[model samples]
Target: MHHFFSMMFSLLAIIGHVSGQPAKGGSERNIDRPYRSELTVSNGMYWGSWGYKSMCPIGRYAAGFSLKVESPVGRDDDTALNGIRLHCIDRSTGSSDSYDYTTIESDVGSWGVWTDIKWCYSGYLTAFQLKVESSQGNGDDTAANNIKFTCTGGYYLQGDGTNWGKWGNWSPTCMGKGICGIKTRIEAPQGKGDDTTLNDVRMFCCD
Candidate 1:
């Protein structure tokens, strides 16, 4: 009887996978992903590979982040923004200087240098907006160039990104508490073709 039940359970698991249902660790898109909200922007461009989802440790949430940006080099291939990294903290701790906090980021492009981290000073990150340039047609194209985040403390923080694109609409506010995970789309270096490093992004919120 035990063997029969075990076989049935295994068969059920296989059936779930075959039927394209969400598995134990993740959905059809990634593994070890965190709880996500539907809060996202509609202005992201399409030109890169989607990266893996990266989540903060449980009980922590994003309060700040930094940008990876390449300074403009005249007459050179310019990829404005390359990546974003989230700095997480435990709001319950109250002591913000603790060494136990964690940092998280998804895939990033190969250019640019990481900048100093920015923080909310009082609360966690709740929503975000992006600045993206449209297709240049024949000139240098830098897709996503800058970003801004809204904090739970009712303030906004901006990244130290390059200036090239127009700001888009903000994403929906977090449904739970604040953002806790991230995923990005980045184009690999095209060697000689126009390269628009960082493209689109998605943030996951947690309670």
Candidate 2:
């Protein structure tokens, strides 16, 4: 009987030890969760553009980019987009110089749903801006009606050009230039319908 009691005590002690302490290694309490933002429109079939612009003191730096767009599935009569194209332009040049051009297609499984777009900068760029556009049938290119941009990683310079500061930490640098930022533009073709309404937009910075 004493041995049986000792075993029960041991089991209880084990249970107490397990419950007394906080979870170890943090336990993935917050990981890989979806981030969200939103854009709204009163018109049903028209195209609208909205975004923010800021000047980052850090001019010459490389950074990562991303964007999430939640768009309602087009009806049977409406023509759906075949793909989305992203353009990174150097605004300082005034010559439409571009750093990167990426296309996200519906088949890539990143569109129609809450689609995410990501890219990395290969060289130092100053005064950078992004443009997202959509394409339909052959010879039909339409700018995204609802778009969002996210800066997930990289260095951003703070302050003005002469008094620049480097923002090494990952933070949302919306519009203009910096770490995490987004600029959205919407364009509707003549016959598609009215302006497109966006359900949501989300941007995030990663560690």
Candidate 3:
């Protein structure tokens, strides 16, 4: 409901802004949806579903991120990583915190509170690595456990996530400028079995 309202308000805000202004003599809007490259984790785990990709607006790139993490559950079912969010900014402006830029995320599991955001001081996010626990036949299963992102400044940011898996190799760096979109795979609830919500993810790049 919140996401839906946010989208609606954004659309209405754009429409209102345009409608309230007089037409310029010879101005036009240019929409670009250029495809750059998609970054993927080679060893991501299984049994989850993919969601539609959510993208940052044109002229912006992801410079930060946040995670929806469910902390450890004693002996009960555990689903460590639940969702991922990409916070976008126009780095050329040199002010990621001055304005409240748009943020987007793909499908999110119905668990966990979003953690504090992590940001790149001067650049955008470039590459990523996932820590995913493989399935345990009859034991607890937390498919995706944690994540780490590399900033264009040559530093890494780790998530405040659970420790249940090994880290995978970093994904290929963005072929363009930086990451601009995201799509995630999530496992549905299992009534009487282990619940491992987040399984895999893909990051999209933009020029």
> If scored against the real structure, what TM-score would every candidate get?
0.82, 0.25, 0.83
**lDDT, candidates in the order shown:** 0.78, 0.27, 0.77
Candidate 3: tens digits of C-alpha lDDT, residues 44-75: 88777898787877777878888988777676
Q: What TM-score would candidate 3 get against the native? A: 0.83
Candidate 1 lDDT over 1-207, as tens digits, reads 113343355346435433563211232222264675846787888998989887877777888898988788678777888888887777797737234456677777766677898988777999999999989998988899999999997799999999998999999999888988889999876766887878999999887
lDDT of 2 at 34: 25
What's the best-to-worst order under lDDT? Answer: 1, 3, 2
**lDDT of the structure predicted as candidate 2:** 0.27
Please write out the lDDT profile of model 2 over residues 1-207, one tens digit for every residue: 113343355346435533552122122112222223222222222244332321111222123232333233333222222122222322344312234321111111112322243334332222232222333334323233332223324433221111111212222343333222222333322234432222112232211
Off by over 4 Å in 3: 1-32
- TM-score for candidate 1: 0.82
Candidate 2: regions farther than 4 A off: 1-46, 54-62, 70-117, 124-142, 145-182, 186-193, 197-207
